[model samples]
Target: MTVKVTARGAERWKQGHPWIYRSDVAEEPDKTPGIVQAFDRKGKFLGQALYSPKSEIRLRLLSRGNERIDDFWWSDRILVAARRRNGITATAWRVVHAEGDALPSLVIDKYGPFVVAQLLSAGLESVRRDVLEAIKYALEPEGILLRNDSAVRRHEGLASEVVLAHGQVPQVVEIVEDGVKYLAAPWSGQKTGAFLDQRENRNLIGHQTKTGGRALDLFTYHGSFALHLARNAKEVLAVDQSAEALARGAENAKLNGISNIKWMEANAFDLLRELERRREQFDTIVLDPPAFAKTKANLERAVAGYKEINLRAMKILAPGGMLFTSSCSYHVNRDVFNAMLADAARDSGRRIQFVAATGASSDHPELLNVPETGYLKGMLLRAIG
Candidate 1:
C-alpha cells in the first residue's frame, strides 16, 4: 500500500518531523492499518511510514529510505535501543522511548526479568506480533506484558487492554535503581509500573541532600525520591494522596531497612499551604507532581497549580536549603515551566539561585529535532535568603 501526502506533509518529513497529519494527506491507501510507503503529491517518494486510518497523525515515518522493514528490522531497532543503555545501572528502565528511540507509537519498559510494552497506535498494533517477537529476540526477557491501556490508543481506534504476551510475569516485581530498592507493579502501576524517567533526577536529589536535616517529598508516589532522600536526611516526610501508594513506599523503605521516612497521606496542594502556615521549614524539598496539564487547553491552569506549590515550597525552605521541582506535562515546555518557576520565586519573597536544570534519565533519550520526545523538565534550586 502507498499513501500520498500534500506538499506541506512532504515538507514536514523533509524537515525531519516524523508525523504527517491526516489533513495533509492527498491520497489515502484503501487498506488496514499497517506499514505503507509514503510519497508526495508530485509522485516523489518521501519515506516509509506506519499508517493509521483513524488517527489525526495519519503517518509516522519509520524510515527515510525504501529499506525493508521486516522482523529483522524490528529486532535491530529494539537491539539498538537496548545498546544505548549499556552502562545504565538499573534493573528497570525504558528500553524503547517511543519517538525518542525513533520507534514512534511504541514504548517498552524493562522491570528486572520482565518487560512491559505499549503499542499506542493502530499502526503499531497491526504489527504487534512482529514487535513482540522482536522484543523476545532482542532482550530474551523472562516475560513480556502488553500494557496497552494508555488513553492515546483510543485516538487510533484501538481498545485498551493489558495482556501477557509471552512467558510469565508477576503482579509485583522487585527492581534496583541507582542502589535503591523498590517494587514495580507492571500490570497496574503508573506509566509502565513506575516513573522510570525520574530515575536520574531522584539520584541527583539523593546526592545533593544534606545530612541531619529535614527533607520533604511532595507527591512522592511510591516514595522513589523519598527513599533516596531518607539516605542522607535525618528525617524525611513523604506525602501523597494515595494511601495505597504510600503503603507500597513503606514496603520499599523496609526493603532498604531504612526507618527515617514518615509517609503522610494528604493532598499535596493543601499540605503545602498548611506547612507554610505552620511556619514549618525543611532543608531539602522535592516537588514531583503528576501532569497538571494533560492537554494544551489546560496549560494556564497547570501553570497556576505548579506555581502555587512551588511558591509555598520556596517560602517554607530553610536558608541555604535545596529544592528540586519538576513537571512532566508534554504541553509544559521548558521555557514556560522555567518562566512559571521564576514567577513563583519572585512571589515567594525568598532569594533563590538556580542550581541546575534537570531532565529525564539517559535511557529516555531526547532528540534535538523532536521536542515532544522530551517532556520532563526540572530545576534544582537553593534558597539564599
Candidate 2:
C-alpha cells in the first residue's frame, strides 16, 4: 500500500530528513504496520518508508527510489554501518545507530560474539525476520538478542519484550575497548548492556588524567570513566545511585586489576553539594549524568539540574585540574549546554579554560542533516585559577 503526505512532509524528505509526522500525512494506508511507498499530494513518489499508524512519526523513509527492502538491502545497509567502525579497536560497538545509520527506529549493538538489537517501531518489528537475517549475514554473530523493552515501543502500540531472536546469548559478555577490558550485561544492563557511545570519550578522559592525582566520577554507571582514570590517578571515587550498578563497577575494576578505584553508592547531586561544603577537592572530575530532560517539557528543569551539578563540580575542582562534563539530553543543544557551563564557571568564581569539545564515538555516527541523531555533546575544561 502507498501512503500520501502533504507538501511539508515531501519537502522534509527532499531535504534529507527521513521522518514525516502524522500531521503531515495526507492519506494513510489501509494495511497494518509495514513498508509502504510514500507519495506527495499530487501523487509524486517521494520514497519508500516504514509506516506506523499509531506513531506520531507516520513515515520513516528508507529509500529515495523504488527498491525492494528485502534481507539483501538490509544486509547492505548493515555492512555499511559496520564498515564505518573498521578502525575502532573495541570488541563492543554500535553496529547500527538507528536514524544515524539511515535505519530509523532500529539499533544494533555488538558485544563480542553476541549482538543485542532494539526494533523500536511497529514497522520495524513487522519486518523483524528480514532484519535478523541481515544481521546474521553481516556480522555472523554467534547469537542475537532482541532488547525491545524500550518505552518508545509503547507509542507504537507494541508490547515490551526481550526475546532471543537467534542462537544463545549469555547474560554477561566481556568486551575490550581501548585496552580496557570490561563486561556487558546484554540481558539486564542499560542501553544494550553497556554505554558504548561514551567509549571514545572515556579514553580521552583517561589519556588526559594526570598521574598520581585524585579523580572523581559522578553518576559512574559501571565505573567506565573511573576505571580509566584509575589507571593514572592515585585514587578515584566512583559514585552512583544504584548499588547494583556500583557492584558491577567493582567487578569491572577487578576485571581490569585496578585497585585504586573506590566504588561508592550515593546520590551524585547530594554528594557534589556535600563535597563542596566540606571544601573537598579533586584534581580531575567527570560529570556524566543521566538525561535530565527526556522531552521538551522538561528542558527547563534539566538545565537547572545541569547547572547545579556543574556549578558544584567547578567549586570543588582543584586549580589546574581537568573537568570532563557531558549531557546526553537531545533537548539540551550544544549552545545551551555550553551557556549553562559558562554560567556555572562564572558563578563558581573560577577561571576556567575550555580545553576541548567532544562528541560520540565514530561507531555512533551523527548524520549532518538530522540533529536528533546527534544527542551526545561534551566539553573538556581546565581550572586555571
Candidate 3:
C-alpha cells in the first residue's frame, strides 16, 4: 500500500504540509480514481489518501499513521469539528466538513435547521455513504441535502448530483442575526443558499454603526449586512444584480416586520459609479462582492476590478463613515488584498484607518502551509474626511 513519495515529496510531508504533487508520485494506483492506501518507501502504512491522476495535487492526505478510514471515524471527526463551531449556528454556518476543514473534497453549510453538503472530489463521491452516515449521526438537523453541483466535480471525473441526504428542507429558513431575522434557502440558493461566513462580519457592521446613519450594501445577497444595520442605522439600502436575491432581501425585511430596508437591483459597477456621479454618500458603505477571481490566473484583472469598485466606493464615503469590504477569493491573499484597498484610498483621496480584519471561523481551520485553503477575508475601515 505504500505509494512511494518520490525524492522531494517526503520533505514536504515531513514539513507538515498535507499535499503531494503529481510529479512526486513514483507509483500509480491500479485503480483509476477514488481513495487508496498510501505508505512510505519502506512499505510503512502512512494512511488513506484521495488520489486523482487528473489533478495537479496528485494526493490529498486524509489521515496519517495508523488511523483507519471508515464511517465511524469520519462521522466522529465531523461532529467534533461542528460542535466546536457552536457560535456559527447563530447565523447560517459552514459545517466545514470539507477539504479545507481537513475533510478534503467535502463542504457542508448549515442553514437554519438544515444542512447541505457538496461532494467536490471523486474520492469523496466514492465514499459518499460514509460521509452521509457521518453527517446524519453527527448533526441531527431538520434536513440534509447533497448539492454536488460545483464545477470542481468535473475535474475529478465525477458528475454533479443533487439529492436529499436526509429530512425535508423548506425553501426559506429563517435566521436571526444580532437580533434581526433573515431567510435563506438551504437546497436551491447560492452556496448552501446563504453566506454563513459573513455572520461575524454582519455583527461587526452593526457594532460599528453610527446613530441615524445611512448604509449601502453592495453585492448585498439577502441583506444580512443592511438588515443588521437597519436596527441601528437610520436607513439601509441593499444592492445586487440578482433580482431573486433582492426579492429575498425584501422578504427578510418583511419576515422581521421591518420596513426601512430598500432593495436595489442594479448593476453593481454602474450603481457604484452612479452613486459617485450623483455625489451620493452613505455613513456606512459595505463592499462585499463575490469572488472575482477563483484562480491565480485571473488575479491581475481581479485586482483591477477590485481597485476600480473600491476607489469609487471610497469616493462617496462620508467623513467618519465606515467601509466594510471583503474578497472571498483564495487567490487574493490578505497582504495583496489590503494593498488594493490602500490603493483605492489613495486614488479616491480618502484617508482611512483599518479597525478590524479577519478570515473564516475557527471551525474552518487553515492548514498553516496551505495558503489557498484560507480564502475569506474582510476588513472594517474608518473613512476619514
Candidate 4:
C-alpha cells in the first residue's frame, strides 16, 4: 500500500516529525492496519510508515530516507537502542523509547532478567511476533512481558492486555538504581513498575538534601525519591494516595535495609493544603505529581493544579530549604511550567534560586525533533527567606 500525504503532512515529516494526522493525507491507502510506503503530493517517497485506518494519526513513519523495516531492520533497531544506553549503569532502563528511537509506538523497559514491553500502536502491535523475536535474539532476556495496557491503543482499535510473551516473570522484579534496591511490581505499579525516568532526578535530590534535616516527598510512588533522600535526611516523609504503592515503597525501603522513611497515605493536593495549615516545614521537598494535562483541553486545569501544589509546597519550605519539582505533562511546556513556578514563588513570598535543571535519565533518550519525547522536565531550587 502507498499513502499520498498532503503538502502540510509531507512538510511536517520532512522536518522530522513522525506522526501524520488523518486529515493530512491527500490519498489514503487500503483501510488496513500494517506497513505502508508514504509519498509526498508530488509522488516523491517520504518514508515507510505504519498505517492505521482507525487512528487519528493515519500514519506513523518508521524510517526516513531509503530504509527498509524488515526483520533484520527491527532487530538492528532494538540493538542500536540498547547500545545507545551502554554506559547507563543500572539493572533497569528503557531499551526502546518509541519515537525516541525512531520505532514509533513501541516501548521496552528492561527489568533485570525480565523485559516489559508496550506496543502502543496498531502498527507496532501488528508486528508483535517479529518484535518479540527481535527482542529475544538481541537481548536474550530470561522473560519478555507484553504490558499493552496504555489507553492510546484504543485509538488503534486494539485491546489492552498483559501477556508473558517469552517466559515467566516474577511477581516482583528487583531492580537497583543509585545503590537503592527496589522491587518493581511490573504492570501493577505505575508506568512499567516504577518511574525509571526519575532515576537521575532522584539522585540529584539526594545529593542536594541536607544531612540530619527533615525531607518531604510528595507523590512518592514506590518511595524512590524518599529512599534516595533518606540517605541524607535524618527523617523522610513519603506520601501518596495509593495504599498499594505505599506498601510497595515500604517493601522497597525494607529491601534497601532502611527504615527512616515514614509512609503516609493521602491525596497530595489535600495533604499539601493540610500541611500548609499546620505550618509543617521541611528542610527538603520533592513535588512529582502525575501528568496533570493528558490533553490540550485540560491545560488550564493542569496549570491551576500545578500552581496549587507548588504554591503550597513553597509556603511550607523552611528558610534556605531545597525544592525539587517536576512536570511530566507534555502539554505543559517548559515555559509554562517555569512561569507557574515563578508565580508560586512570588505568591509564597520566598526568594528562590535555580540550582540545576534536569530531565529523564540517559535510558529514556529524547529526540530533539520530537518534543513529546522530552515529557519529564524538572528543576532544583533553593528557597531563601
| Better by TM-score, candidate 4 or 3 | 4
Candidate 4 lDDT tens digits, 186-240: 8676788778899989889999899999999999988999999999999999999
Q: Cα deviation in Å at residue 363, candidate 4?
A: 1.8
By the TM-score metric, which is better: model 2 or model 3? Answer: 2
> lDDT of candidate 3?
0.80
What TM-score would each prediction reach against the true structure? 0.99, 0.99, 0.94, 0.97
List lDDT for all candidates, in order. 0.94, 0.93, 0.80, 0.89
Candidate 2 per-residue lDDT, tens place, 204-283, comes to 99998989999999999899999899989999999999999999999999999999998899999889989999999999
Put down candidate 1 lDDT per residue, 8-35, tens digits, no spaces: 9998888888999999999998858999
lDDT tens digits, residues 1-385, model 3?
Answer: 3466665776776766667888888887764767777766766666678887677777777887567778898788888778778755475677774656677777877776688888877666778888888888887787888887788778777777778878897877877766888887766777777777777788888888878989888998888888888887889888999998888889888988878888988988998889898999899888889999988899999999999988998889899999888999989999999999988888888898888887765656677677767798888898877
Q: Model 4 reaches what TM-score against the true structure?
A: 0.97
How close to the true structure is residue 34 of candidate 2, measured as C-alpha lDDT?
Answer: 99
Better of 2 and 4 by lDDT: 2
